[model samples]
Target: MMHGLAETTTGALTLEHIGRRFGETLALDDVSFSIRHGEIICLVGQSGCGKSSLLRIIAGVDTADSGRVLLGKTEVAGPDRFVEPEERNIGFVFQDYALFPHLTVEENVAFGLKKLPRHEARERAAAVIARIGIETLARRYPHMLSGGEQQRVALARALAPKPRILLMDEPFSNLDRGLRERVREETTATLRALGTTVIMVTHDPEEALSAGDRVVLMQKGRIVQIATGYEIYDRPNSLYAAEFFCPLNKLPGVYRNGRVETALGAFPAGLNLPEGGQALACIRPQAFRLAQPGEGMSARVVRCSFLGEIEQLAIKVEGVEGTLHMRTTERIEVKPGDDVRLVIEPGGVLAFPQA
Candidate 1:
């Protein structure tokens, strides 16, 4: 067992080489990470990417076939020792809220305080309800509350017991776009104010970027990259990781003389690339610019749409067969059949090895 002081200094949760298999499918493969006190981490990936499996293993809802889970220096899940979920003192907030229809907001928050004295439980429940800014809805049943209200009640209930760590499984997935954003901001602020450690699973890139202190991107039951939101967006390690976070315009070309020669034009490679090797270059829509007729690569406008803040244009190059979309702030004086020139900005190109 690890020493108590060392554990306190490191974190409250640790997973070492965790792996879980279900018949022919491998859910989690060699997963390892740690979460410290009063920190929030977000796990992000496509569906069936082992994020939920890792959370379940940590919560003790599912056992790992191989590996050890340590909560505060105590081996919660291992070959010889298995600690029950309740004994681990970890709270979980599910996607569906999971509020009991029969219970009021106040009663639901008080549910987990059963071990405490009656008066103390009531006082704690009241405190949490007020902290969540839902004291007015204390008497409302789950069925009567709106989606956002129920979400707050569920969170209040989970935090009422003051668990060492909190796990949220796509908690904002059910709400509408507007409500989801509001609830996310509110919940994140609440957690930070209380100095609560949290691990949340999400498929939405925006949610992962805005809500997490660090974002962990997973693929094929393995972590592909772990970094801050800005790092993940600006410096993606792999093509898959880049495509996962935003729309990538993949241009097929060859790298030569420290530059990528594509159908559009030759552009300097921002990062190192193998000389004279075939690669796929990634460019965001905002990276391209409209140029004069003869100055840049010739292309014909295919379509145009007006977004709120900017205009989206689809242009087809003479040499490049498919349509390429670009976003620009300035409104272009062009139509669907209008011919235009495409200029790729320097240092905007990201090249990866061609598969």
Candidate 2:
């Protein structure tokens, strides 16, 4: 299990059999993953899924009851030994951009560098401030800055420490949607320029997919899938993995003879299923293409809504229990009760067999 020097650029982090619990709740369960050096990975999951707990464990701020955490070649935490947070070469950015209220922006960024000589600390702070383009606001207090400006100051402070690994906990949650997008892009660029190995925890699936080089998706207390945005979304390991990225149109059926037959059509299971097992043909909303009458399953349009670039339709297919949602860029001429035909895209049908 030796990753070469190229793979261990900044330093590798390996977690083996990490587990944590709080009274009646299992916060983490046998979590294990390896983070490559200089990689910006997202630890993504819903609330209560242990993403934050895992980040804290990696930073050595929290201890795991059972596991081994290795940073570089050094064992930071294990049953035999534990390293304190200060001893771990980790930098952290809290969700609220925790800046010192009373201290000026420059002083706050230089706070961690105080261990060095006074002259060297001041030089490092000035260099980071200039790099972050926040030198204009150096003397200003936290309250004098806007949300975005304060975030920049916080980032400057984190970068000033020159930590081997940076752990960010929902760093953009406080900003509005528009600002979040802009700030996220800015932060990504900054981190890339610095070549810092980062593991960011986020609850937003879209954000995780877009921001991270690799996305580690979690459910309950363990990882469900880990891959790039396209890989996880296009080749999900299960129905749960598929639905997490986008809305799904589920068509239930029985799996047999290597196929799952549904109201729309039959799809290849691609894997063996239990005999007569309950299965679902999961399709994306954008998968449905309009076909001529008599060519495919006939459906009557019950609802249609026009978005800016795409149109959404709710159609009731014959023998189907619920309205099927479809998105298309083609012009829509049909209204309520208008009969239409629909077909599934070859790439869209995913069959998941349930035990």
Candidate 3:
């Protein structure tokens, strides 16, 4: 509720060899990571990738099958002990908001502060509601408010108790596109202002890249990579990690010297591979740009589609099977069966060992 209520640097969290299982399925496989006192990290992956399960384990709602979780040197979930969710001082905002339809916004926010006196809880709720600029919605019920309003109320309720660590499970998935962006920006700013330690799970790659200070990418119940958004996007550790952030155009070739030699052209092998070993060049659509007819790789435009701010071109290049897609904002006057030359842009290509 206050500007610096969560400013204390006492809520550092660490997870060591954490594992979870649902019957025969392995949900999390030796997952491990840590969070700073007031840092914001985003957990991103495909559905059932154990992102939500990991969050539940950290929140003490679900038990870890193996390993331990430490919050400021205290083991919250481990072999020797297990702390209940209420005692962990962790706040969770579920995917659906989970606001009670029967209660008004004010009452819902005050719900978490029941430990305080009734009057004091109401006062705290009011202050948070006003702080989020949602005072007018205090008396309105959940069913009467828009999706964005409900999301704000959910965030207010979570922040009401000033929990040491806040876990949000797809908190912005329910809002429309424009509103989701606006609310995400506002919520991120609010949380940063409060200096709250946050772990937010998101399925959207763009959201994860833009919102998080660092992105933790998980796959098949294991962490594939953990790095800042830019590092993860530009320097992915594996082919899976590269494909996760964006659709990639894979060019099969052989690694020679420091480049992968394909029929079309040679591209820098970002990763190390044995000489003459098979390598796959993972190039994003934006990496292919239009060049003068004879200056770059020769290609024929198969199709072009206007997509609002940008245009998508499906082009055919010699020695490359199928059509390679390219996206650009330039207004290229091209159509099906048109001749074109394309150049590979620097820094948009990632090389990996061919599977």
Candidates' TM-scores? 0.94, 0.92, 0.95
Query: lDDT at 315 for candidate 1?
Result: 83
Say which candidate scores most in lDDT. Answer: 3
**Ten-residue segment with the worst summed lDDT in candidate 1?**
1-10
Candidate lDDT values, in order: 0.88, 0.87, 0.90
Give one digit per residue, the lDDT tens place, for model 1 in 190-235: 9999999999999999999999998999998998999989898888
TM-score of 2: 0.92
Error of 1 at 298 (Å): 3.0
* Candidate 2 runs further than 4 Å off: 1-11, 331-334
Ranking by TM-score: 3, 1, 2
For residue 226, give model 3's deviation from the true position in Å. Answer: 0.5
In the predicted model 3, the residue pairs found to clash are: none
Please give, for residues 294-324, the per-residue lDDT of candidate 2 as tens digits.
Answer: 8877888999999968999998988888888
> What is the lDDT for 12 in model 3?
83
Per-residue lDDT for 190-308 in model 3, tens only? 99988999999999999999889999999989999999999999889898889998999888999998999887678877556778999987789998888885798888999999998
